[model samples]
Target: MSVFAARVCGFAEGGKRRHQLRREGRLMLNRFLSARSAAVAVAVGLAFAVTAEAKTVDPKTSSIVRGDAAALGFDPAKLDVARAALKADVASGKIAGAYLLVGRHGKVAFQEGFGVQGPGQAAPVSDETIFRIFSMTKPVVSVVAMTLVEEGKLDVDAPVSKYLPEYANLSVWQADGSSVPAAKPMLVRHLMSHTSGLIYGFITPTAPIAKAWAAGGENRNDLTAREYAKVIAKLPLKNEPGTAWNYSRSTDVLGAVVEVAGKKPLDVLVKERVTGPLGMTDTAFFQPEAKRARFAEPAKGDAGVYYDYAKPTPFLSAGGGLSSTTEDYLRFVLMLAGDGEYKGVRILKKETLARMRQDETTPEIRKAGLFFPGPGMGFGLGFSLVNDDTLQRPGNGTFSWWGIAGTEFWVDPKNDVFMVFMVQARELAMEYQRKNRTWIYDALVK
Candidate 1:
């Protein structure tokens, strides 16, 4: 990839690694990240809320209803190019296995799986293969936060300390390993857009903050989300809150904020509002022991797993902790595509979804720290919006994000197109995203 393309995160590049099943029956886990930004689009259209009580979308939501190339406004010949190119990646050993589901006009035109489930797992990947959707978790949690905002349980403009005082009076971290008082308090909105200045402590093992966090037992799974936030609260920040759009543990902090603001734990809030309402049955912080076999592992030597799915751990990493199936996540996406309502279940208002897509950062802030969304994009509540197509291929008003593992999704309201591409190739997420977009764009005749 070109240097510019390599910087496409949310749209990110991948590296190689492998891991065997760890903890015996429990599977190992790892985290990966992507960043990209975009311009806003007009709301597709306001979807009227169903008057009847909301219900979980059936588990077999849209798979059986997939349309054909001609019927769905796609060029069959061009789509074959996309098909062959994706399968070629498996032949080249770039990914262990993957599946891509493409939809337009509320119907699927194409969906297919590509390789074996994992390193030693014999099952071939299918619609049900579960993935550790690292940074993609950010958008899910952000959507949940908006639900709270809609309910008046949380105020985006309020200081984060309103909910968690532990985050109060925090200092900024300087390059020289010294600290100074922050110019202003971090706001709830800053946490959602990644401008809170609270970065991942373990990103650079040798960094002073990383060392400090490790010494304070920050990585212990035994710590609850709230306790994890407390450990982060005592640390200095990378920059002033709301001043820079650094990819940090801001969402993780938002989890704690949600707990205090909603008077319930983060996982509980997500389940009650998002997963449960939308029938995203397989999406959660921990995978069940019976479902461990369905977990997709990265190619050998590509990445390491961070959590054991069989055990109930306490650290709810709202930033990168959840595992989900393509079907489960697709229901969540349809809600966004449907302007916050899936099937009959409404989780957020159309205006709130649009608000999430509007740019929330300045150009200077996006470029300030670890800016990974690449050129021609802008940061929104949790995902990147394409202002224009100068840097990437997606249409204007397209919003998207991805996991560090070879997983990505983009919804182009303008084109009535969206795709969910899932893979365990931690090192190839960016290449795959660009490839996936190109394939879909070329294949579409609409």
Candidate 2:
């Protein structure tokens, strides 16, 4: 049987069987720690203890019921099947480790950790294991921008050139190698919805503008957000503003806009306005050195590399730069699922979240199939909206997105479900995402 199946079987056998599994978990943890340096082992052990003590929620008022799948309206047997499938994939060596959390009706219904920290690492994956969230950072940054909007500091419909004057003279590139002055200025909404005409340098390596971005130190660690914005504005756009939807570095530009409008650094603004209010203590641009032991390592065969999470870079990529634990991010997503409130802390107004979840893509853009990777989806302010319920598993009106490093989350407001899957392997991100979605939805009994 798979490792996950064995654990589930133990739970079925009674208290004695459950005790055996707990003992086994401790034994494995101890053996893993023995191979690591003393200092590292001690730090990891402390982190594990802290995670164990943290409550998923207040049990009395929470819908979360530990190991009671039926209480949360899930079939226990199907949940077992889902766990086995995930463990089988890990055993196949496609991914190094994974963490999953499912919340329904405002409480955690299921939570599980699988595999080791990395290919050759001894540490076992746990709730506290931090993973690089990549593009998932976009949603958080978008919400922060909305908060500025609430304060009358930023306007989504305003011309982006109003905040960053360098974009005023921007031009658009054509297939015939000619350039034309943009007919209209790009708006803040365009950036948030990925209709700003910008393109990611690495997405199309052979394009002239993409090549120019790379040659100009677009990913340089020393370049500040302001400096990067200036560099990006000078490049020719991939399309006319609002004419097409490209998964671009527009959120990073939005980050620069937020910094200018909020009159603070991007990191500081995110903490003060979003994460801090939501109680996501483990989410940040720079992973602390002390928590380095708890950070997950990527798989050996990830398709692309990531920036050093432990190193502080001036760029502060709002598009794809953030590390967070499963628990910390769950709180963030739960807030969204609850329509801007979590445990009574309101990070955003209900109306703001409603606006964020609405489809912002034009039918023309959707028909052209340029908004995002999947079918039957539309682009929202900072997320992908489910346009056709028949095509995707999540109900209509769901808002979701994922990161390149295999982290994904979705809030299904229609079904009152919020699920997060955290992993460090990018080679099979979409495949794993589909598998997890299928398994989770299949086990849903409500």
lDDT for each candidate structure? 0.74, 0.76
- Candidate 1: regions farther than 4 A off: 1-54, 60-64, 202-218, 389-392
Model 2: lDDT of residue 418: 83
Candidate 1 per-residue lDDT, tens place, 172-258, comes to: 877777789888999999998888987765456588876765666555556778987887788888889988877777888898998
Candidate 2 TM-score versus the reference: 0.83
Per-residue accuracy of model 2 over 201-316 as CA lDDT, tens digit each: 66667878777767665555567788888988877888888888888879988989999998999999898666765567888988879987787876674222654568776678
Residue 34, model 1, lDDT:
18
TM-score to native of every candidate shown = 0.84, 0.83
